[model samples]
Target: MVIELYTYPVGFIFTFFSILSLFRLKISLTIKFGIVGNILYCLSILTSIPMMYYFTRDTPLLLLLLSRISLLIINLIYLHKLRLKKREITLEDESEIRKTILNLGTKFMRLEVREISEKCGFDRDSIIGVLKKMIINEEIYADFFQTTNTVSFDQQTNIDEIDRLMTVYKDWEKDHYEKET
Candidate 1:
C-alpha cells in the first residue's frame, strides 16, 4: 500500500517533467511522444485504484513497470525523429526582418533595427513599422535608445523579427516576381 502510493506520485512527477522538457527543448517528436506517454501512464496509475480494490493489496510493481515502459517507448520514438533529415529554408521563404537582423548581428555584432534596414537595403520606415508589430506581438523586444534613436534586439528578437519579415516578404515577392516573370 505504501509502495503503491509512493510510486504513483513519483511516476506523475517524471511524466510532468518529461512534458516540460519536451517543450523547452523544442523537440517536436519529444513533445508528441511525451504527451501521449503521459496520458497512458496517468491511466495506468489510476488503474492502481481498481487493482487495490479487487485484490485488497498493493500493486506498485505493476504500475511502476507500465509507467517505465511507456516512457521508454516515447524516448525511442523521439530518438528516431531526431535522425531524420532537417528541412532547409529557401530564399523565397526567408523573412526580411529576421534575415536583416541576422545579417546585422553578424556584421555589426549588434541587432539594431536601423542597421538592419541599411544592411538589408530595406526602407527604414517599413522596417520600423514591421518591428513595431513584432514588439506588440511579443515576438521581439524593441528597446529604444532615446538619445541615439537606435533600437536593438537580442537573439530571440532577431528570430522573431526575421519570422515576421519573411511572412511579409513572401507575399510581396510572390506578386513582384509574378509581375516580372
Candidate 2:
C-alpha cells in the first residue's frame, strides 16, 4: 500500500518545501524539509527496486524509473532556484516603509517605535523588523534600541555619512554576535 503512494509523495513534498522556502519566516523549516524530503525520496526509490523483480513487465519498471528520475530532476531544479533567491519585499511593504520614512522626515533624529507604528499605521514589531532590515541592507541610518524601545535615526543624508555610520553599526553587530557565542 505504501509503495503505491510513492509516486505522489516525492513530487508533493519537494513542491511543498520549495514553496515554503519562498517565505522568509520559515527558512529553516524549508531547508530541513528539502533535505529530509530528498532523502526520503531516495530511500523510497531504493526500496522500490526490489519490487521490480516482482513485476513480470519491463514497461512498468521502465515507467516507474522514468517517473522517479523526472521527479528528482524537477526537485533539483527547484532547489537550485531556491538557492539563487534572496528574501524579497512586496510592493506594499516597500511603499509602506517609504511613507513611514517620509513621515519621519529629514529633521527628526529619533523617535519611539510605538510612535512610528501609530504614524505609519503599522504594527510596532513589524516596523522594528523592517527598520532593522533597512539598517542592515539599505544602510539606512537608523538604530532600533530594544531597551528604550526607541528608534534613533541620523538626519545626515550624505552617502559618506551613512557609510561611516553603517561601518560602525557593522562593528557593533559583529561584537554583539560574538558575545552571544
Candidate 3:
C-alpha cells in the first residue's frame, strides 16, 4: 500500500521530465540525425502515454482521464512547435547548401555536377536544383550546362559584375542618404 501510494506521482513526474527533455534536445534528434533521430523522438512520446496511463489506472477516473488528455495536448503542442523549428532549420540548411555550391563552383574552371553532389552528400538532382537557384539569384558566376552535365566558371566575368553592382549600390546610397537624413 505504501509503495503504490508513491508510484503514481513518481512515475508521472518521470514521464513528464522525459518528454520535456526530448523537447529540449530538438536539434540533435530532429535535424542532425535525420529519420532515426525522429523515430527515437516519436517512440519516446508514444511510450510515455502508456507509462502514464499505467500509473493512473488505480486513481480516480477523473485523474486518469486528465492525465491522458493533458499528455496528448502537450504532445500535440510540442509537435507543432517542432514542425516550426524544422522549417527554420531546413531553410538554414538550404542556405548552407547554396554557400557550399558557390565555394565548389569557384574551385574549378569546369566541374561535374555529380562530383559536387557527392561532396555535399545530397542527390544529383538536389545539387542541380541548388545550383539553378544560385544561378537565378546571381549568387554564383557560372554556366550550368544540362546537356553536358557540367558547370563552368568565369572569375573575370564575376569580378566585372561585382564592380558594376558596387557602382549601382553607391549611386543608390548617395541618392537615398540625403533624403533619409
Find the candidate with the highest TM-score and give its number: 3
Candidate 2 lDDT over residue span 29-50, tens digit each: 5655665665565566556666
Name the lDDT of candidate 2.
Answer: 0.67
Compose the digit string of candidate 3's lDDT tens values, residues 110-163.
Answer: 878888867766656666777877888878878899998798888677667667
Q: Order the candidates by lDDT, highest first.
A: 2, 3, 1
User: What Cα-based lDDT does every candidate model obtain?
Assistant: 0.60, 0.67, 0.64
Instruction: Give candidate 2's TM-score.
Output: 0.36
Cα TM-score per model: 0.28, 0.36, 0.38
How high a TM-score does candidate 3 get? 0.38
Q: Which scores greater on TM-score, model 1 or model 2?
A: 2
Deviating ranges (above 4 Å) for candidate 3? 1-89, 159-181
What local lDDT score does residue 161 receive in model 2, on the 0 to 100 scale? 66
Clashes of 3: 0
Per-residue accuracy of model 1 over 131-171 as CA lDDT, tens digit each:
55555776555564545646665656566666889989999
Clashes of each: 5, 0, 0
